[model samples]
Target chain A: MSDLLTIENLKTYFFKKKKVIPAVDGVDLKIKKGETIALVGESGCGKSLTSLSIMRLVPKPGGEIVEGKVNLDGVDLTKLTENEMCKVRGRDVSMIFQEPMTSLNPVLTIGEQLIEVIINHQKVSRPKAREKSIELLKIVGFSRAEEIMKDFPHRLSGGMRQRVMIAIALSCNPKLLIADEPTTALDVTIQAQILELMKGLTKEFDTSILLITHDLGVVSELAERVVVMYGGQVVEEAPIDSILNNPYHPYTDGLIQSVPSLTGEIKELHTIKGNVPSPDQFPKGCRFAPRCHKAFDRCFNEHPDLKAISDSCSVRCFLYEDKQEEEEYNV
Target chain B: MSKVLEKEILEKESAGEPKQEILRVTDLKKYFPIKSGVLQKTVGHIKAVDGISFSINKGETLGIVGESGCGKSTAGRTIIRLEEPTEGKILFKGKDISHMKEKELRKQVRREIQMIFQDPYASLNPRKTLGSTIVEPLNEYNLYGNQKQRLERVGELLETVGLDSSYSNRYPHEFSGGQRQRIGIARTLALDPEVIIADEAVSALDVSIQAQVINLMQRLQEEFELTYMFISHDLSVVRHISDKVAVMYLGKIMEIADKNSLYEEPMHPYTQALLSAVPVPKKHGATQRERITLKGDIPNPANPPKGCVFCTRCPAAMDICREVQPILKTKKENHSVACHLFE
Candidate 1:
């Protein structure tokens, strides 16, 4: 399959008074048709900002995408005019936010929300749009579809609201769907249902997903590939199995180790010392060098670029840099 | 107040005898009234917590794992007397403190039971320095007399929670989320409380910071011989920190067992589904359990099911499950479950 969306060296920054903070410093990503890729990171790591950049929806008054290309189906989104980007947003790329409650308009009924998206994107009659809204609700797993359409967002549960959100996002059959922490606000059982629904819908509609979340378990269960970000930069990108089993980046390894195992003997959890640095206070060299346990003298003075160690795996750490070079020389 | 209890538990553990009970709650019920219209006449009750029973041994941790609105937080609050119980008994060291007057309770029981809230930012007073916040409890109880001693005690408590003693002078806004949580822990410890009710304490932290705080809590438990009622919605965390685990749904415990039996071979249909619902990070194509996806959302708590609260969504629900509420009964050695299948 050919690539559906490709991001190259994308940089998003926030201007505060005189200083510029690089919230998303140079991120590169790709998703093939029907592929589901997860962008995993903590709160301030710029995973959400990267997704926003792709939608041409980075917040204004301070934030802007300053560099690189977000090419979707041979079109660079950053170069598009405001009016053109608005048209491309719902028809070609749709997004679901973390809090479904806040993302939805409270006053509007579920049917109105779904119908507006359909009418905005496709040339359909009012009656036809309403029909499509009910059908979309059924596809997202609502038994009483008509009753749900009449219900307000507050009347529905968090999981139900999220399903409605997904219904609207997929109503246009966008090529790429950006879901930022889609299941984080729900219960585990409900989260399981949402994950299953997303997995099935993406496969059935042939929609590519850029799932952004901090939960590794959600990433492990649904995504085919995983991209780990830290301090506004990509630290590792690999097949889900490699990232989980044989992770090359120290930060990735620490994250995997930090999660309490469900099936093992209870031992003291491994912790990465210190906290995630704020964007304004990021280190001069490697952003992770301050808290990394395996840091050496050189790691403190130089920042490492993401280097591919194998055909399918890449890492950003001084420890992996020498190993990759030695392998290339031997080859 | 807590030192005497600590010595007793240490003696019991050293002698290899059954552990002493620190806190016990029986048939605890808390209901908030719902009213309508301008007159605001009481119509019905939202049964936040309805008749739950559990006990914690001294120096042990009881993990209460459930979904939101399952009454886990309410149970924690009621036990701490933050919310008055509608009915039932709360026993602290075999003494009923459920109906004690507020003044008497504060003088006797409040110092022994402290709570750690989830949102470290909202829970802390932003305008106050860390020193004053930690020392407020000490001043309330009039401990470590004299201003100099209280200030010194604040520094000592900060260092005990893996923070620098010098940080006592800094404000809450000056610290990170993880550091603010440590400050909360230090404040909780200032009272030398025997039983700490942590309501979703580490749920708001990042993964790495969560590990650090969990490790800190475990170490503090060892040092102070503290008993904890760790209530959270995260099962993996509960499995890691709890010696005993209770799975709750619609304000009732479906199963209660040691961590091993509960995680390895869950008995109740609700417990089975809940454990399977947790997304375990696994290698691709790894062997995993067949997930039991529940049918619908939890029913309205005000109008719970006539029988088992879980029967609406339970996969293995039978006819009897819809008519008769299953009482929690011993199913195996050291394990109890509330379900009709075993009956």
Candidate 2:
């Protein structure tokens, strides 16, 4: 599979009150064609910022992509003009936000929203766009597509609103879909439906997905690859099975152990000590060392760079230092 | 609601077992009236909690698991009398206090039952110091002795929840989400309440922080011999902390059983579907779990299905399920399911 979107040394910084906060510092990611990669982290870990930076939608005045190349196909997005980037956004790649309620406009009907996106990217007649809108609604699992088109966003449930968001994102038939906490606000049953729908739609449309979530369960269900982020850096990246079963990073291990399982005997849950530090207050050394149980003297003073342990696995920790390769793995 | 069930519980308690019922709720219902038009006349009632019954033994956690608007929160509030129950009996230590006067409640039931709110940020006063916020409860009940003793008690309470006693002087804004929640727990514990009704207590926290708080709660439950009515939408966390679990939908419990029975062999179709829908992060081949996707959203609580509340989306809903409401009945030892299929 060819790489659809590649981000190299991505750093999104927030300049607040004359202080530069490294919100997303030095992230490297590659999404293969028709593949799904999950960016997993706690709050303030810059997972959302990474996705925002990719779409060039990081809130301005304070936030900016300080450095990096967001290469989609052959074009470097960072070098593109504002006008050029606007055209590239919905046509080449689209995004789905966490809260479907706020993301959608209440005044507009579902049909209006869907058609607007379709006509915005593709030069199509209103009637044709409306026809395509209903089709998109049907594709997202709406049985009464015609009625739903006329209904406002407020009339639908959380699950239905998310489906509408998915429909609009897919209306352009973009090569890649970036869903940021797509099902976080939904109930588990609704989340399951959405996940199932996304899986089916991915296979059908052959669209690669950059799924941003704090949920390991959601990642296990949809993503083939997992990128574990902590304090604005990719601490670990590996295949889903390896990440779940045998994580290289101590943070990853602690995270997997923390979540109480549905099937297992009720045991005392393992906890990563302390809270996730604010982006500005992030430690100078390895970001996770403060909370890490296995931190050593070296882990407290020096930052460990992301080093590949194998062809498919990479980790950022002094514990895995002996196994790390001298050369970086090629995407 | 059955005499037989009450007798069985009492008989078990008398027959050498020390399982004394701390709280028992029978046919609890809370209806919020919806009035419209110029006259503001009585129009309809949003049946937020409609006839839910359960009992919690002394020092055991009874977890109430349900989706939003399923009346789980309302049920908890009504039990604690935060919200007045429209119709039902709330028995604390085998005495019905559902219609008790506010003054009497403060003197009797209020001191024994405390509630920990979900949003740690909204629940506490931003302007107040952590000491004052916790000590306010002590002041209300006229607990401890002088100002010095109260402040000392406040410091002790903070230390109990794993926060430094020195943090009592700090404001709520100075603490993180987890730290703020610990403060909230401290406030709840200041009264030395026997039953703590925690509503979505850990839902707002990150996974790691959530585990820390959960562990803290467990340790406190043991230390204080505290009975908990832990209400949350998160099934896994509920299963982990609860001795018995109740699954609610559309203002009624679909199933109530031991965590093992409910999680492993859920009798109600709704319970089964809800469990299956939860995505588990397990090793490959460890989970070949069949997901039961329920159709449509929860029916409007104001006008829930005339038949079964869950009939609208129940995957295995029968013809009878559409015409008649299923009453909750014990189908097995210590397991109760409210589905017609069990009959």
Runs in model 1 lying further than 4 Å from the true structure: B1-16, B284-286
| Highest DockQ against the true fold, candidate | 1
Predicted structure with the largest TM-score when compared to the true one: 1
The digit string of per-residue lDDT tens for model 2 on B148-244 reads 9999999899899999999988888888899999999999999999999999999999999999999999999999999999999899999999999
Clashing pairs in 1: none
Residue-level lDDT of model 1, residues A1-331, one tens digit each, is 9999999999999999999999999999999999999999888999999999998888998999999999999999999999999999889999999998898999999999999999988999999999999999999899999999999999999999999999999999999999999999999999999999999977798999999999999998889999999999999999999999998888999999999987787679999999999999998778999999899988889999998898888888889877898879988
TM-score, cand. 2 vs. native: 0.96
- How close is every model to the real structure, measured as TM-score? 0.97, 0.96
lDDT of 1 by residue, B1-343 (tens): 7989988887777469568888999999999999999999999999999999999999999999999899999999999898999999999977899999999999999999999999999999989999989999999999998989999999999999999999988899999899999999999999899999999999999999999999999999999999999999999998899999999999898899998999999999888898899898996566777998887899999999999999999888899999999999998998999999999
> Can you write out model 2's per-residue Cα lDDT over A1-331, one digit (the tens) per residue?
8999999999999999978999999999999999999999999999999998988999988999989999999899999999999998888999999999999999999999888888889999999999999999999999999999999998999999999999999999999999999999999989989999999988999999999998999999999999999999999999999999999899999999999988888569999999999989988789999988899989989999998889899999999776553443332
The residue pairs that clash in candidate 2, if any, are: none
Q: Please give me the DockQ of candidate 1 compared with the native complex.
A: 0.79
